[model samples]
Target: MTWLRALREIVRSGLTIERTRLEPLVALRAAAGVAIVIGLALWLVSPAYAASSALGAFSAGAATFQRSWRPRKVIALAAGAGLALSTFLGYLAAGHLVTFLLLLATWSFVAGMAWAVGPTAGIVSAATVAGMLVIITLPTSVGQALEHAAVIALGGVVQATLILLFPIRRWGAHRDALADALAAVADYARRLSHDPTAPFDAKPMMTARSAAAVTPSQARRRPAALHGPRGLAERIRPAVAALADPRVGAPAEGPGRDRAREVLGAAADVLDAAARSIRRGTPAQVPSGAMETLRIDEGDEVLEGPARQAAVRLASLLGEVLETADSCDTHVVPAPARGAADAPPLLRPTMFRLVPVVLRAMRRELHRDSPVLRHAVRLATVACLGYALGTALPLGHGYWAPIASVMVMRPDFHQTYARAVARFTGTLVGVALATGVVQLAHPDAYLSGGLAVVSAALSYLLMRTGYVASQSFTAAYVVFLLGMGGEAWDQTVRDRVLLTLVGGALAVVAYVVFPAWETPRLLDRLADWLAANGRYAAAVVRGYGDPAGQRRADVRQALLASRDANAAWGEAFGRAKQEPVRHRGLTRREAEDAQEAVQSLGQAAMLLETHLPERGARPVPEAARFAEALEADTAQAAREVRARRNPDWDRVEEALDAWEGADSGMDPVVRRGAELQLQALEELATAVDRTPLERDVASSRQERHARAEEEEESRRERDTGPAPPPKEEG
Candidate 1:
């Protein structure tokens, strides 16, 4: 039954598709690029050379489709260089079978380790492997090897040129990312307006943050042109999140709540409109009268004071974002602000100094406990085993087995197993379809090449839909691609299916024997999140005292660190939940409570940061003392979480009581923010103190019965009179 349940889950997950709005455009561009390059190569070059060149071009182009023009160029150059080197080495080693096998194994191991570097490196490494396999199979001398490598490099160059020619999509991607961020903000605002206590899911906001982060990497090369929209999105995220905080935006009853709801709704409408405008590359226009509600008279007090201020601030921020979106659409880079001489000089690093910094960062990952290191070793081992098995048996196209194994294995067991299943199933179905098409149509080289282009296009179209669908198209594409290279269709299909099965089996076995299970590390990851949030909260509270903006950078850095740590824990927890029952260290309910606690702490910290005025006004002495006490309490809670011990609830409650008493003479806004922070902290403490297991059933029942009887006795006393109570006391 357990196995049956697992199988059902795997199937359901594999079949679930996620559709994005821009996928069609991305797929169209990718298909056009690959098809045009392959067509030109076939027409201008020899048939065999064209096939090899087209493969390299298509692989590099596919790997870098989503990157900006600058990164695309960089990737193209890297891919070309890698392909040339692999092809030359493979050609040189082909004469000696023992040497060739050894070289292949070594290359596979190194390529497998490339996953440790990052996603871009992993893609480039895979492309190199594919190039080597293709080159080694062709009967070629040393001279021919150089020629083939040159042609392959030329293919990558062509793809890069095409990207430069068609750079419009880069801006489109940026717009879509910003729009996603704004839309997420709008959703959060709507939820908060309806109910302050409504459950807030940080996943959407986190996703937007990640998208905003990606834009900056590309902007480094063309800052003036690309940075404005990305920066606007980044600036707007915190403000929008702050507005959703119950503390910052809490309204009074009746007219106050009504006005608050109207203002929030209007802000959401404006944000959504701005997002739509950016997505469509049009001028942003707010709805008629939307901004009117945000304007507050000096004497007007219909909306609760702090909530009204928050709404006004949110409206102003939304206007700024819309203005930026308009500028982006018009391609007008905003001029740098006047009086720039008054600002501090930006600290720029020289390339020579930067190299060592990068090396140090990479070196930090070279440790026994690093997941990347462990996964790299596992991948390399599986690759070698897969290769050996393919060679030992009389399997045709033995490299496919190793390639499949390398592709299927990931850092975690859930992904590895899922990919293996998807790969095998998709390959089987794809081969059957391709076999039928070939037998019926008998496509010539040019026709087969076209079919391959169509298949590749469909693969990109459905890439985010599901692994099964994407891999199915990918398999069909490979079959057609090989046919263009003059392989027999029936034999190719059989070899592909058999080798994929063998490779997937090897991958599964490797993970079963030596798994990097996420379960055991879940506690540590959660603890890291707690500690990082604690530091973030403390830094934000301390910033209220720094009038010179001395701690502003520190606050931003701490927030980023906390976000990263939380994301890491979320990923680990997600993987842990997917594991077998016995393997999961914490139950789902326990994990949820832990995550909620961390999120509440983070929200409270963000609320403090947002409400803290610029040109910092001195907080009242009592408020200062309360801030210190809260900071201490947060630190203690972090330690308790790390140690897996119940936090001191009494101490936390005492601190809260002290903070409540210390609110005297504080600014009304400061008092409100402090009160909200105290409540959030209390919630965090409660969540942290909850044991994984519930109280004993018998004890709970007895306690409930006793409480009910006490309530009944009190009700009877109130109804009868106070005389009986007095007599009993005497």
Candidate 2:
């Protein structure tokens, strides 16, 4: 009876352990990896070890943690997880050196598969996983590789557990950064509107429009409950963006930084108001002193430097918005359609949309004359040299070829140079650390094995830090492996130093010779993006008369296109910072152009809708003349914009002249149409001045909505459905 009771207790414990130990997929990977290591260790081909497999598993788990923390589409997260887990399992099951190599290749293939399906998230995972796998599987052995595999799997499991259970506070930090940015934009807007001394030209308009453009979507996706202060920061990205208009230029009082903060603060206020409107289903009408709201009293306030400037700038922007709202003589436009038919033809196709063009343009600027490409070429050349030396030295392991390639190829020249220097320096330090551990401990299988675990831990810590940390760990692991193989310290040190110089030299050569130009490519890409957006905006106008179904389709496509373009521009700008002198102004002009186009399209859509009932109102020749003059000015604006990336002063003057002339001599109907067109042109000009795409898109949507509503009203009146009397136009 006692034995039976003990057995029952044991069974219950086992069941609980099985349920709580690991996720089913993860458990299966651990089990499978262990099985392969056991098989290979038994085979014992020479002094085979299991560190590589251990590293692989650890890396995969680390990737899983990275993915789970980000906001991703459901399919992306699932596919990314499956691919990473499967790679771990594959590495574990591969029993021979060739099998291990195949496993590494398979891991990359799987990660790529996920990337192919998921876009940004998938590609990032694939690159990291592939890079790590190649580093671990250098010698590629089936026999005696299980131990390495197990260590790697254990490291991975621990990392995954820690991230899932503890959750890092970094995401919160990012959120805060974004919030700070928003406050600055809002403050700037307030200043723009209220400051009597400030310029009332397109500069203020651009700043105000950009702020409004940036506030909406950013207010939607952030999760404040999870991130707290940091989340609040992220939620203000749009608000921060509002402060980025180029016309704001340098602030007069102190440094430009303070102005930026003021602008951001005003943007934040607007966002707060906008968010309230969204939540409560009530719109915040534009205020009269919106322009004055942005006025910065240089004499007042406790804040100094960039913070004060940013606050003032935001205040000005808010003032501007209020004024614009109060002065609006026409109706606000409705949202654009969310369908392809309602959007531009270029956007109808999901692939090769507007964004790529923008990206490509940015790329062209830097890459066309890129120092980075020269550096890459130099590095590739040096890698070939190392390969020759490694083989000639009779070490005959072509393994260093890829190592040299990986270590030297910087994403940019500065990074490449730093990494090369760091890799060589860290290699010396790592080899020394390994020698000290081996000498003091006189390593046994257990002691050497313990060192392996330590190496995994070090790798895990270094994993998120940066390239230097990763390289440091790689060197440490290599030194440990050398010790495990019973190599003499002196000989190991000599070989390591030699390879370090070889790798470093090779990398420099590649970097110098195979430069990857990033800027010019990005500019051309941005141009292409603008062209595509132009087409999409056009389609949206054409479909404005269609039912809600068509409008919905167009709006979605346009929104997606705009988003893609925005994201591409963000990345391109990040790349641009590396070569600001070369590519700084390339996209700035195009962005401005797109903004104007969006405004024009929006106003046109609204006017057409207003006249839908009056399409039968007949062409009043006087009104037609006014409309024609307005159209001519728009055409001239477009041509001038297309010819010059910056504001074409002559063309702008001509356009304003035409607009003023047309405004003076027109029938009421023509006058209204002319005014709408002029308003759109001004808004478009404002967008160009700001250089942010979001403002242009928002303005365009506003136009589309106005047009849609007008058309619907006309149809309803004609159809005579029960309806209220038309409200007086502003």
Best by TM-score: 1
Candidate 2: lDDT over CA atoms? 0.42
Model 1: per-residue lDDT, tens digit, 1-730?
2556756666676667776533776577667766876687678765576577767776766666534323565567667778878878988987787777677767765665566555656657766865786677764678888888887787677767776876655556556665776787677668867766455455555554444443333434322323344444444545545555455665334556676677778877878887887778777778988878666677766644456666666666666666666654445345532211122322333334544654564567678777766776777677667766777778588778877887777778887888888888888888888888999999988998899888888887776666687788888988888888888897788788899999998888887787777777877887788778867876776665454453667777788788889889988988877766343335567668778867877777776666666665664555455556666766676677667765543443454346543434444555555555555554554454444352343234336435654664576468676532222234
Against the reference, the lDDT scores of all candidates come to 0.66, 0.42
Give per-residue lDDT, candidate 1, residue 546: 53
Clashes of each: 0, 180
Among residues 3 or more apart in sequence or in different chains, the pairs in candidate 1 whose N, CA or C atoms overlap within 3 Å are none
Residues 48-113 of candidate 2 have per-residue lDDT tens digits of 344344344434443542323232122222333443454445446434555554554444333323
TM-score per candidate: 0.84, 0.47
Q: What C-alpha lDDT, on a 0 to 100 scale, does residue 464 get in candidate 2?
A: 38
